[model samples]
Structure formats: C-alpha cells, structure tokens
Target chain A: MHIVVCIKQVPDSAQIRVHPVTNTIMRQGVPTIINPYDLFALEEALRLRDKMGGKVTVLTMGPPMADESLRKALGLGADAAVLLTDRFFAGSDTLATSYALAAGIRKIGEEEPVDIVFTGKQTIDGDTAQVGPGIAKRLGLNQLTYVAAIRSLDLENRSIVVERRAEGGVQVLSTGLPCLITMLEGTNTLRRGAMDDMFRASRATIATWSAQQAGVDDIALCGLRGSPTVVKKVFAPQPRKEKAKMVETAGKSDAEIAQATLDTLFSANPKLETDLRKLAAAS
Target chain B: AKKELSEHFKTYKDVWVFIEMERGKVHTVSWELLGEGRKLADKLGVQLAAVILGPPGNDLKQAISDAWSYGADLAYVVSEPLLKDYRNEPYSKALTDLVNTHKPEILLLGASTLGRDLAGSVATTLKTGLTADCTELAIDDDRCLAATRPTFGGTLLCTIFTLNFRPQMATIRPRVMAMPERRDAKPGRVIEFKLSMVEDDIVTKILDFVPDTSTEEAHLAYADIVVAGGLGMGNPGNFRLITDLAAVLGAEYGGSRPTIQKGWISADRQIGQTGKTIRPKLYIAAGISGAIQHRVGVEGADMILAINTDANAPIFEFAHYGLVGDATRILPALTKAFEARLAVRRMAS
Candidate 1:
C-alpha cells in the first residue's frame, strides 16, 4: 500500500491584509506555510502507512521554494519527497495541474505500484476542488472528496470504506483500492515529528523532477498552453461606503447599556421584535 | 460562440440547470440556479431546460413543475430507483450521458454538496472545464459563459471563460443569485431519459448514514439570526460569549475562518467563502475585521451589526450597525439585555 500525498506551500491567508487605500494584497512579510488543509491529508496518509507498513511519498508541484514544504512533510514522517518544478509548468490552471500531477504519480508508480493518492479537499489559493477529480479522470482512478474518516482497509482484497461528508448526513462509502482521496479538514490532529524523525528528514535527499523527468510526454499539456479556461480580469471587490449606525453605551451600567442598545435595535428595525416573537412562538 | 470554438461545438444549444433533490425534497439552490439559467438562456435566445435525475415518483414530476414555474422552458427527467440517493458514480454518469445525448450550450448547477460532487465528476468525465462557486454568470457576446468568482483568497474577482468547450459548465454558490419570479405555474415540455446502468455497475456502495447530531451543528445557512465571533474573541473560553448571546436570542452561532483554523470552532460553524455562505435576517459579528473572505459570506445578511475595539475595522464599512468597544464586555451586555427583554415578555404573556 504505497500512498502519495499532494501538498502545496501557500501564503498564510489569515495574515494577508488588503491595503485600505490601494485595495491591493499585501504579501510582503507574509510567511509561507504548507496549506493548512493539506496537513490533514499528509497526516492521514502517514497514519495509513504506519498501520499498513507501507511508504508515504509526499509530492508537490511548485517553485524551488516548495522544497521547503516537502522537507516539512518529511519531518512529519513521510518516507520520501518529490518536487515537480519547471519554468514551463508555470501558469498552470487546475487542468494542467492535474495533468502534471498525474504524470508525476505515473512516473512514481513505474518504480513501485501506487495504491492510494491523497490530497486536501482544495488548495487555499485555488479554492477549486477540481484538481483531484481532474487527476482522477486523467489517471482513471476512483476519486473520493471530502472524506471525514477511513473506516476499513483490506489491502489483499483491494477494498476500502470511508465516511464521506455529504450535505445533510455522512455517507459510508465503500470503494476499491488505488483510488484518490481528498481528506476533509479537522478530521485528525497532525502529529509532531520526533527528534529521530527530524534528523532523518534533514538527511533525506528530496527527488527533483522537471516536466520531462516527471513523465510529461507532451509539454503542451503540462502548463498554460493546456489550460482551457482564461481569466478575463482580476480586480478587488468594491467596498461599501455606508458605515454602521453606532449605539451609544458610554459609562452606562449593564442594564442601561442593554436597554439603550435594544431601544435602538427595535426602533431602527420595527419588525425585528415581531419577527423574533413569531419565530419563538412557532418553535 | 467564440471563433476558437471548433465546429463540433457549434450544434450545442440551449441552457440546462441541474435540478437537485434529496429525500423527495428539492434544494432551494436548484431553483436559484434555474432562475439564473433562465437569464443566460434568454440572452442566448435559446431554451432554458431543467435536468432532473431522481427516483420514479410524483416528487420528480413536482420538481419539474417547480423548475417550470421558475421560468424553465423545458424539463429533462431521468427517473430510476438507483438514482434515488446521490452516488457520485451513478449521478455523474447519468448527467454525462444526458449532456452527450442532448447537447446543451451551457450547464448550471447549485454549489451544494451533491452538486459539487456531481459537477466535478461529470465535467471531468466530459473532458470540459468547470468553474465552481461562481458568484456571477452571464452569456458573453460570443455566447461563452462568463463565470465570475472571488479568487486569490477573495482579495480579487476573476471571470473565467471556457471558450472552447461545447457546454460551458459552472456551479453557483447558494444565496449568491436572486431567486427568479415563478411564472403562472405553467407546464413545460418534459423530455424523459433512461438510466441504462444498474446498481452493480457502481463501484462505491452506500452502507449507512449518520445524521449530524453534534451540539455544535450551527444551522447558519438557514438561520434567521447569526452571531459570529472572530480572532478578537480572545480564546476558546470566550467563544461562550457568542453561544450565550445566540442562546438568548434563539440565534445560530458561528465564527470567522480564522477561528476555524485556530480550532476554536468546528468547520461547519465557520462563515466565509471557503466555509458556509450565510444569509440571515440579522448577523452580529463580534470582533470581526471583515476581510473579503468573510465579507462574501455575511454580505447577504439583511442587517449586520459589528462590534470591534478598532473603529477602523473593515467590518464597520459594511455593517448596518457598528460599535467601538471590547466585545468581551459588549457581548455580555447585549446578551443580558436580550435575555432581560425576552424574560419580561415571557412573564407578561
């Protein structure tokens, strides 16, 4: 049971603030971290490897700096790391991205048959959960998204069951092995790397693969040339100019403060009380 | 049609909206998409069709009629017992089969769990581009679907074009579009299709369903009143301030994306672009900075009241009501006030 986990290094979106006057993204001084969601996938893969006695290879397609993320995954007990970076692969959308990743996974499988490919539900930057399905379609692998938990695995029979989060309920789905699974967030806590594992990770040699080396036979299908969707424009959201009406509560007692705010709330929206009363009565 | 589109795609006509249903109940987002799809159909001077795949019963017929009332000119129905519950393999195959058999120029779906799951697989299976979570959809001069969505962590908006694809497909997030007016309950042309595949063909089998029973299940999407906390809440202990206020007002409690990432709240309770898009009558955001990510989710709230110590917080710019004070103190004050007011009503009544 060999597993490949796809991870990306993204700028911490929480710290990213837009310049008020310019309405431009302020990326300076914002540190890059492995996509927070990807950690759950990486951890899930490592846990599977631990239980099944297989190797977990962490893979990423990004700039040279993305090696830092692969190294971080290695520190967390991934058996191997591969970085797919090349100038030609730049500007790839989800389609080209899935193409490159499928090629990379195929090349890895040429050495050892890959059983499961894992990725986060979606990348923070892209927020498009298309890549996993795209890759699955390209590679003809069974794809499962938003998996909350891995229930059972029978490597011999090549069967697995997972709890997938659906809209109103959870679907306990059973699928065959050699499928691609996108782990949902908050399913498990990422384990901290031990001292021995940290030392081993530092000494591990990260495999470097260019577009050609990653089994990308047609370079045209690997980057911007392959992407069908085109972005027409990129602009900041227009801000609303209306400021909120402030409720005064300066130096007032708790009871008075509550009374004043309630007064303003009821006065401004005269029907609010009626609506709440209706809801209360019905419930 | 763009000049780049091959002659093979020229024959693709009409706009189709996938009508989503579960447990014999139609999801409201499906109607929203149908409403949106009707406009694109009108713009292209083509027919607006609703595609329904479900079990064989009156539920499917009612769904088609609902779609017709929502301005659809036609309805495509594929009824089968196997299609009762949404399994990606069967649903995607059934949808892909429908698209290939009857080529529609554009396909629209609601960005619900079922829609997202089915859209990705169907689009991939058809080898076409799919834009997800679109905020806007319009037919371009060239007849391309201009799907616009917030990108780069919601800092900017990007309009994507599937220029060469036969059926330009997109999934619009719920609450982003206005529900269209229902025409005088007219019946549309119904085209019924067949599900050729059997149950054994699907590799994935549904074993059991466990409905969400956690106390933290914040029904934020449909809540009339929502109270959300942010990083300003200080810590996990202070989250009680939000829940306490919500309990008093019978409102739902949620948090910003940061609180979810920080593990202060569950992911379901997070309100933002990546989380849940909530449209409540009143949304009270405590100590929220109102980033574009969070703004997209709460902007639909009928009235937003924001409380933050920083008067310069972006939330104030959009909030219907604003206050400059520590939420730690303000939250408790508001809670006490609401409780007192409601308690008095209970006694008087």
Candidate 2:
C-alpha cells in the first residue's frame, strides 16, 4: 500500500497576537509549527503503513520553508516527503490549494499507485475544512471526512471501513481504496521518533516540485487568478465600550462575592433572573 | 475587472439556502441559515429560496413549509431515493445541477458535517468559491455577498467575496445566527428537480449508524447555559467543579482546548474555535484565559461571566462579568449560591 498524507505548516495560532493600534496580525516574530491537526493524520498514516507493510509519503504545498515540516514528518517515520512549491501558487485559496495538491498526488502516482490519501480535518490558519473534500472531488477519490477510527481494511478486496463522526452519532462507512480521508483531531497520539529515524529525517532530501513539474497544466488555475474568493477586508473584532465589570473581592469571601455578582447580574437584566427562576422551577 | 466578472454572473438571481435534512429531521442550522439568508436576500432585493434534496416523504414536505415560515420565499426540491442517504456524489450532483440550471446569486449552507461534506464537493465541481464557518453574512454596497469569518484561530475577522463566482457560497455553524421567529405564512411555490444518478454512481456506502447512546455526549452548541474550564482548573480531577456547577443550572459543561489536550475532558465537549462554537444564553467560563480561539466560540453568548485567579486574563476584556479568584474556590461557592437561590425561587413559586 502507498499512502500519501498531506500536511501544512501554519503559524502557531496561540502565540499569534494582533497589533493593538494597527489592528492587524503581527506575524513578524511568530513561530511556525506543523499544523497540530495534521500530526494526527501523519500518525494514523504511519500506523497503517506499519500494520499493512507499506510506504508512507508525506506531502505539503507551501513556500520553500515548508520543507522543514516535511522533514519533521519524515522524523515521525514517514518513508518519503514531497514539497509542491512555486511562486505561482501564492494566494491560493482552499480550492486552488487542493487543485495544486491533487496535481502533485497524481504525479506521485506515476511512480507508485497511491491507495490512500490522508489530511487533517482542517488547517488552523484557514480552519475551512474544505481542502480534503476539494481534493477528493478533483481527483475522483472517495472522500471520508472526520474519521475517528479505521475499523477494518481489506487490502485484497480494496475495501476499508471507518467510524465517521457525524452530527448526533457515528456512522460506520465502507468505501473502496484510492480514497481520501481527513483524520479528526484527538483520535490518535503522535509517536516520538526513534534515534535512527531522527537521524535519517535530518539528512533526508525533500523532493520539490513546481506547479508545472507537478503536472498543473494551467498557471492561471494555480494562484490568485484561480481563486474565486477575494478577501475584502481584515480587522480585529471591535472591542466593547466597557471591560467586564469586576465584582468587589477585597477581603470578601467567595460566597459573598458570588451573591453580590448575582445581584448585579439580576439588576442589570431583570428578564434573566425571571428566566433562570423559571428554568430552576422546571428542573 | 470587477464589473466584467459581475456582468458574467448577472443571470444569477435570488439567495439560496441549502436546507439539510437527515432521517426525517432537518438540522436547525438549516433554518438558521435561512433566517440569515432572508436578510441578505432582502438587502439584494431578491427572493430567498430554500434548496431541499431528500427522499420523497412527509419530512421533506414539512421542511418546505418550515422554510417558508422561516422567511424563505420559495424552495427547490429534489426527491430521489439516491439522495435519501447523503452520499456526497448524488447530493452534490443534485445541488450543482440546481445551481447550474437556475443560477443563484448567493448560496448558504450550515457548517455541519453533512453540509461541509456536500458544499466542498459542489463548490469544487462547479469551480466556485465557498467560505466556511461564517460568523456574519450580508450584502455589501457592491451588491455582493460579504461573508465575514474568523481567521488565524479567531484572532482576526476577514470578509470574503466570491468576486467572479456565480452563486457565491458560504457555510455558517450552528447557533452562530439567531433563530428567526417561525410565523404562519402561506406556503411558497416548490420547484422539483430530478437527480439522474443511480446507486452504482456512489463510491462510499454507509454500513450502519450508531446513534450516540452515551449520556456523556455534549450538546454544547444548543445548550441554554454552558460552564467550561481551562488549564487553570489545576488538574483533571477539578473538572468536576465545572460539572457540579452546570448540574445546578441545568447547563452543559465543557472545557477549553488545553483541557481536551490534557485529557481532562472529551474532545466533543471542548469549547473553542477548534471545537464547538456555542451561543448559550449564559456562559460561565472558569479558569479560562480566553484565548481568541475560545473567545470566538463563546462571544456569541448573551452573557459571559468569567472567573479566574488572574484579574488581567484576556477573558476579562470581552467578558460581561468577572470574578477575580481561584476557580477551585469560587466554583464551589458559586454552585452553592445558585443552588440556594434556585431552591428559594422554587419554594416561592
């Protein structure tokens, strides 16, 4: 089995801060990490490869710096890494990004047939959750999203079953091979790389591909020109006129403070007190 | 350039909301989008149309009526056995065909699992742009759909426009928009479409569905009130304080993303941008520092009461009320206070 796991390098959202006056993201000193969700996809791919005796290739589409993320995935036991990067791919939205990645996956398939493609449920920076399905649509692959577990895999039959997270329940789905799966976060823990793997990854050369090399026929479809959506404006959420009113707590016990807070809360919103009272009575 | 692109899509009219239904029940987010779609439709002076694709049944009929009551002016219905179960192949085909035949200026869908699954495929098939998890939707001065959504883990908001794409598409999460009042309205005209796809066309098959029987499943999004904890709760064992407080108020209990990472709570109960976006009437955040991710999820709540040991926690900036104290100490006290207050109110009633 040949599995291609798609990963992305995104700025650590937790550490990102907006400029107070300019009201824009301060990306200057922010650090970039492998999108945390993608780690789960890589680990799941590694586990599948280990069990089924196959090769796992990690793939990413980003700037040249994204090679670091691919190397990190190799350290985690992936057999190979591919970086699809080019100047023409900048400003690609989810649709355009998926188009580039799909082309890269097709090029990879020329050497060895890929049985499965894996991606995280969504990227942290975009958080759109559209790329996996987008890729599947472009490549004509069965799209299985929000997969919590791989229940069974019949290699001979080219069949796979997975437990998919749904709105109110879990759906056990069966699909053919050559499918795309978006692994949900927290489903599995990433493994620590062994000494040998770490050394191999540090020295492993990542294969880089431009849009043309990746078999993208149309340059217009690879970047801003291909993107249908345009970002009109970006700004910080407007701050409320007043900060949270603090309940007095100078030498006051927790109970007293709670009572005082409730009093103030009720006085400010008289309907809230009545609603709560009614709910309590019903409960 | 903008005018040329707009001219190409001039044939597309009206605003369409995808009404998602499964197993005879329509997802509430569908109605929520219709409510929001109504505003955009009115702003653009276009009709609000609900798109329904399902097996022919009373549920489908009821959804049509409900859409009308929720402000839809008309509906497009495709009743096919293949669409009974939402296999992305047929649903996307049905939706894309509808958009192609009768183009719409704007299309909205709920950001639920099913909606996301179908939207991505339909958008890709049609070569259109789709914005996901939009917090706000409106028609801009340019007569284009302005889809505003949180970006970079909700630290900033960005408004997106499908400049050249006809049927500019967007998906909004559950509870993000207010539920519009359902009024008695005359049922609107329904346009029926046929999905020519067959069973052999679908690649994925549903073997079985196991409904959530575990009581631990968190319905945080629709909860009337929510109480959540964070790393400041100190340890996993202290999460019970949040649950205890929730029990008194008949509210759901959740945790911040850090707590989920720590295994202090299940991932489903995580309340943040990466987790669930809730708009409860009352949100009590204990020990949480209110990262942008968490703030975006809970900022929709009618009232937010933040309790933390640090008075300067970022949570205090947007919280409606703040109590500066150890959550371990304050949670229990607050629980008791609520219990006593409710008991008194119950007795008085």
Please tell me which predicted candidate would have the highest DockQ against the true structure: 2
For candidate 2, give the lDDT of residue B84.
73
Worst 10 residues of 1 chain A by lDDT: A274-283
Compare the candidates by TM-score and give the number of the best one: 2
**Which DockQ values do the candidates obtain, in the order shown?**
0.57, 0.75
TM-score of each: 0.92, 0.97
For candidate 2, the per-residue lDDT at A23 reads 74
TM-score of chain A of 1: 0.93
What digit string (tens of lDDT, one per residue) describes model 1 on residues A1-283? 8999999888887677667766666779998999988999999999988998999999999999899999999999999999999998987877788889999999999999999999998877778888887777778777788899999999999999999998777989888878999899889999999888889888889999999999899998767777667777666787787788887868887567667878887888988877766555554
* Residue lDDT tens for model 1, B40-157: 8889899999999999999988898788789989989998999888787778888999999999989998888778777877887776778878998887777788999987667777
Candidate 2: list runs displaced more than 4 Å: B1-3, B6-8, B215-218
